[model samples]
Target chain A: MSSFEVPEVSNKQVIFKNYVVGKVNDSDLEIRTSQLRLELPEDGTNDVLVKNLYLSPDPYMRSRMKEDYTSYVPPFTPGKPIDGYGVSKVVLSKNPAFKEGDYVTSFTRWEEYSVIPGGNGLKVIDTSESVPLSYYVGCLGMPGFTAYVGLYEILKPKQGETIYVSAASGAVGQLVGQLAKLAGLYVVGSAGSQQKIDLLKEKLGYDVAFNYKQETDYNAALKKYCPKGIDMYFENVGGKMLEAVLDNMNKFGRIAVCGLISQYEKENSDGIHNLSRLISARITMRGFLQADHANLQPEFLQKMLGYLKEKKFVYIEDIDEGLESAVGAFVKLLSGGNVGKQILKVATD
Target chain B: MSSFEVPEVSNKQVIFKNYVVGKVNDSDLEIRTSQLRLELPEDGTNDVLVKNLYLSPDPYMRSRMKEDYTSYVPPFTPGKPIDGYGVSKVVLSKNPAFKEGDYVTSFTRWEEYSVIPGGNGLKVIDTSESVPLSYYVGCLGMPGFTAYVGLYEILKPKQGETIYVSAASGAVGQLVGQLAKLAGLYVVGSAGSQQKIDLLKEKLGYDVAFNYKQETDYNAALKKYCPKGIDMYFENVGGKMLEAVLDNMNKFGRIAVCGLISQYEKENSDGIHNLSRLISARITMRGFLQADHANLQPEFLQKMLGYLKEKKFVYIEDIDEGLESAVGAFVKLLSGGNVGKQILKVATD
Candidate 1:
């Protein structure tokens, strides 16, 4: 009935230039089209072709630009397409593990088409109408897991404990506050702007939200909010905020250091002096990466999906369309321009 | 046997004059004997008579000078003799659990004689030839337990991890270095003077030792020694050393804050601006008191006794004879003049 013309094999990929030094420019990235077909290459082993639909512009991606080693995580190799968390659909599979039409989450390059090994980089997602599929990158994914593990596992927040989170309206911070609220904690959060603070209070449901920019002195602000003292601090934005939090922490307080967007672009980072407060308060401060919480993924997804289904949870998504806007969106995410999870939409179909 | 009249029971005790403001003076303390008898009150239920033998002159006693609520441990009541770890011989016990002629340790006041609750204070020490009796207050006591938990549990040091201990010749710092070395770690220590640095290197067996007093720039000194960056930092003298350590720490570096002796005397402590490094470095910095590590006591004693029996551990004591000299010894400990664990001999007979 139909003699089909072979589909034009033009693969569009996002390429990274030589490592960015200071504030990352859009010119640091270029979208180039490759003549290679979207089909999986005829390598004899298990490789699959994926049509990337959603790409995550995470703050930690900035770490890949640095050359030095950071704990258990390795820096991404330059001169190649930088890869991060993305939602994709399997187009063709040389391996039997994934079928021709299955939704999956993978660490793939910023591209419309990619070929990756079947076993290592792919995780299958069971979809439902309860929430949007893009939520796999936010609430039910890495960011949500990061919030859960950092708050519950690291901080071990007890009921009625006072909790403070920086970057309150950011992807991770927003979820952290909600979870803290669910745990019956007295929660306060710091955001970059009044709009974000309002969003944190009205949309995300933080007990108290303060625009750090409006607050002249962080210590005074902490004293005002906490009054008695903070029992747990979810540290995301470092610098003066951390110093302030340290001074107001209760005895045996806990701090879970998740990120530091403030100094990610700076050459010489700011120093905090009041760390001695850790001893005086007998605080336990721990740093954790989300990958360490893989074991909690099942529990995280089950709980988050249940919340979404019950309409008890609200998540904000700052979606930037097309691969061309990925670089700009990523820069904005780092600069705290975006309120929530920054997701770049590659294609709808 | 020569007939001995029971020592005339003067019930008076030492009194602290005013709250210690700056460096404690010998004149700040005055010893006065009271007309109270050594015998416990006739109706006492849990009372015991303890003739004080050895009392510890610890650095934390200096915190009692301040009225700040930031204190993790409660401050000693002013105008009363300071209380800390002490070794004593029981003379009488109204409580049946303890009896006469038993050697015990208690948080007793800095005085020759003390009547304590048998149930409330004191742990009987089984006399063993493994170590000296005074070792109970030094090596096998608070300092030793502190080093054990902070280095092993809190830091969770990996073999070959680079560890830096401040106040390397102090009671806790000295043991931290030794235990770190035994754990197959690369240890570096910083002390205030050249003599202390030499002691850290030669007697304490630290891999690299520095005199913080001689070094103009602490950050430069840290970078020079820790080229690969520090993995664990044992904080004692917190202020500038903490700031410098933060700058040089590797990602996921752990800091166990045991004491902040340098800031204890200051009314308004100096601001350390380098604390934000914890987020960038992804450091896990915790503060602890040794009394909280009671669960690990058995393990600590076993390991410490093994080390002591093999002569793998060596302890130094700065012993001040008589109860009257106790106040001066405490002042020296806070001023960093004492070479090792400061001890006060009460009776010794």
Candidate 2:
């Protein structure tokens, strides 16, 4: 039917312009409209054409913007679509594993529609649950899994232990504090703004939430808030914040480093002083990636759904409308301008 | 018999004059002669007297020289006899656990004779073997145990992995390099002096050894020596050397921070930069104390003794004769002037 009269299926995409040095600017990414062929290739390639619903612009994406950044993911190619974790609905499928109308989460591009080559990175989502679709990119997706693995595996939180989460209002930190509290830990958090700090205490049920901006001295603030000292630290922000955590960490304390969002922008960062405290205090500091613990995904999804259904967990997401807001949403995320998990709502089912 | 004529039982001791600021100087300790009454208490105190043999002036002891250093052991009490790990001969005993003439390794004062109340920390050495008695303090005691725990427990060496030990010719590093080789690892090390470097390569059998003092850039040095990035690091000297190791650390690397000898004398240590690499590389850096792994001691002692007897392991010690050389030996040890395990030979049994 489409061959006779082609539908006006012009796909709007956020394109990577070039690799960035320090902080990413508006010029680093560009919004461009490109023609779409809504049909799969007949060359034995199992590509699935999907209509993008939501795109999660996480802090980790900034790493891909660097030319030399090597990690689990390869660097995004300049002049092409930027891909990340997103929610999508299958429009057409050549892959037997996925079919039309199948709702799923996959590594998709920042575009109105994406022909996910060979249906790679796609995982079918169970739409039978009443959970919001965007939660796939927020709580039930990568960030949530990161929070879970970091807390349970690395930190190994014990009941009554004090767990301090930095960037407590951000995507991963929000869930970490909530999960720590469920595990019978005394949860403390630090966020950039008063609004974010209030959200941490009032909504997230953190025992103590402080505005790091208002408090000039991080060490003094930690000392005041974490009076008994921090038993475990969920580190997101790096530099001064991490140093302060080291200062307040108790003997045999553990640190789960999920991100260093603060240092990503700086070419030259101030090195951590008092790492010697790591020796005197007998601390175990580990850097972790969620991909390493993919085996735990099935249990993670099930348990997180149970928490959501029982009204024990509330996940907050800041959604910017359409593919046009993709760059702005990511920029806001890196600059600490957004509240909760930042997402770009490309379309609605 | 003493009623007719008194014996010249003068206890010549090294007394701590005061706590040190910056590097410890000659004035910080004093050698004094005090008379001793060579009799055990009859009031059921369970005291044991020991004649000191070899005293280990380990790098960790420098921390105790500071007035405010808090750790597994308390700071050395100024003006009181400096207590340390030593090889000794039990002179008199009311305690049934240790009798007179028992050769043991224990926490003994730096003196000709020390009254160890209740014989606490007295671990009797099995002197049936032909190994040197001074070996008790050097390889078969605390230093050797530190090496064992750091290598097998902390680094968790895999066969064919590269392990780079800083302060390679020192007490702990010497044993660490040897143990790593036994574990089927490629071992590299760094020392301060050319003599120490030669000792590491020629005597200790390290695959590669470099004099860190001659290398201006530690990162470059590690790159040259450790062509394959280091998988495990036995961290002894902290600061710039540690920073360089971080740059050369392979993904999923483990750093066992045993000591920071370079930082012990500094009032303000240059903080560690490039810690963000920990996150990017997913590295695990841990600080450990040997005492915490005391359960592994029996196995360590037996295995090490076996290695020594088999001639598969060679332990070298630099002995400074008499209690008079105690302060000088300690200075040399901390300054990296002494090669191998630095020991003060008191009244050798």
Candidate 3:
């Protein structure tokens, strides 16, 4: 019945070499090639084959590199492709939900191709407009939803209130500032670089942005930038930054604990003092995972799509070309090497 | 026409000598006698003259001793009497809210008699329930209300969930343990000494109790006692104990930061590390004051009164006699010297 032989494909991949310790290095991951038949397995299993286009290089991934880390995501298997959120095109499908040529955002391996069982978590992308495919793995993906849920759902930003976003130029922080601004909040931000600070203040519509690395005292910087005091905090970088923010928060302030990117690679995470301020200020510090707020996805997509269509939202992605650049992009994302949302561009069209 | 000639009285008082810097001592306070005519001022300030009966000496008073401290209540004036909640009888009333010879709980200074302007914050005691007048300063006053609000409103414990309370034998903590127990929670507590530990487990109905002073590693102690992981925490003692509790909390756990007595007298508060767990565990840490939820007082009174009337609650007080002992009782309360609620019995009948 086969008119021609199915062509084999060379699947290039980024494989995690071992359980990482302390800070990660380029050597911890290796770019290699493996043979693939480009077909579903013979076993009676419902699965879909997808060719990955772009992969997100996120800071939260650092926690999963440890052998015995506590996180929602499990540790990466040694000698296996690193798994993460990515944009892909369904190459083949045995599941009724997905078909060939369907463009989707999915939990895919860090490889040219991945076989997703039951086509689970494959969200079909609405590529109706002129939006780039790479944005699906960055601004319109998990990172974007994280910003939405963390701000609107958790912190519940009110009009005329002030919100401080740390790591302001990063994936989640950038969008949080913009969303808070749209919601009529006085948005303030702190980033490591002058470039990101500029982006936050100018392009992202933050009321004020400061270079935290240049600022000798975070508390003083917060006071100078946010004169009225911070009413809400989107905490990304932790340790000393958290302590300072806690001191400056207004009465009944809320803190959305999204990520502690700065402390991820440290041998011992920084100690946060000044928690006595929590009682004095009646602060509510809540740590959250976007997966827990999956109920907000549909609304998040509609609102974010509207912002993009209206050109009201600025989605910045630092896309590294080729699959081989994934490790570098990931390392940059963790080390604040990238200027914006870090992503690895694996394919075009 | 005067019904009787007013008698001049010598008021024995404890006055704050100065703004205390380090740990408090007996020298920081002075017991002095001052003359009182027991008459309202001629300017008609609508004040009431109160005969002070029982005085509450609490850990929260330690913060007021500092010149630059931030609290809902302002710092103590150097030349004025130390103010606290106390049971008193209105000897003379110009304000219609209180009448002569009526027993009430009011914010009065640490003295035998106090002239309160406008009868502000005075709650008349029924004396019909047969509850002791001193109970108003201990179990039925701020500390009891503190435990009520912290457990029910902030922590919101669920049946069968585990609750860990620090400073478990102290004023607020003892009530929190008993109330949480009544709420069908698995209550684990930690105190400074073995006697307090016995009181917590044997009498207060805590499922388990440990001496934090004896436990070398607080985290280890929590793990051993709270085998199921802590879902709700009544955080009375902060610093290292808070650090340990944060690590032991379960996902989506809640911490009611009622008091941080351990850090109140310290020059520098302890640094809370492992806040990264706040994100991983998706915890909610809230610091609250019972005064903020003042509306709950009537209900707190009704429920607590029922608990007492039905002989369901045990209220213990380590009462030191007279105004002269106020300083020592207060210092003992701060140093964990008292077995239960620490209060000064200013006068009987």
Best by DockQ: 3
Tens-digit lDDT track for model 2 on B72-186? 8888888888889998999899899888899989998889999998889998888897788888887888899989999999999999999999999988889999889988999
Off by over 4 Å in 3: A1-6, B1-6
The candidate scoring highest on lDDT is 2
Per-residue lDDT of model 3, residues A37-120, tens digit only = 877865667799999988988888888898887878888999999999999999999887888999999999999989999888
* TM-score to native of every candidate shown: 0.81, 0.96, 0.96
> List-wise, what DockQ does each model earn?
0.41, 0.75, 0.81
Task: Write one digit per residue (lDDT tens) for candidate 1, span B1-349.
Answer: 1225445565546677667676688887778776545566557578988888998888877777666534645766767876778898888788787889888888787777787865466888888654667889888999889999998888998997899999888888889999999999999998878878888888888999988888869999999988778999998888777888988998778889888888877765666654546655667888988777799999898889989889887887889888778777877888888888888888874
Model 3, B60-132: lDDT tens digits are 8888999987868999999889999999999999988889999999999999999998889998998999998
lDDT of candidate 2 over A1-349, digit per residue (tens) = 5575645589999999999899899889999998887777778799999999999999888989988887778889999989999999999999999999999998999999999999999999888997899999989999999999999999998899999999998889999999999999999999999989989999997999999889979999999999999999999988999989998999999999899888889878778878888889999999999999999999999999999999888888898998888888889899999999998899988
Model 2 residue runs over 4 Å out of place are A1-8, B1-8
Which DockQ value does candidate 3 get?
Answer: 0.81
lDDT of 1 by residue, A75-194 (tens): 766667888888899888887778877888888888887888753578777865446768888888888889989988899988998999999888899899998998999989998898
* Worst ten in a row by lDDT for model 2 chain A: A1-10
Q: Clashes in model 2: which pairs?
A: none
User: In model 1, how large is the Cα lDDT of residue A91?
Assistant: 86
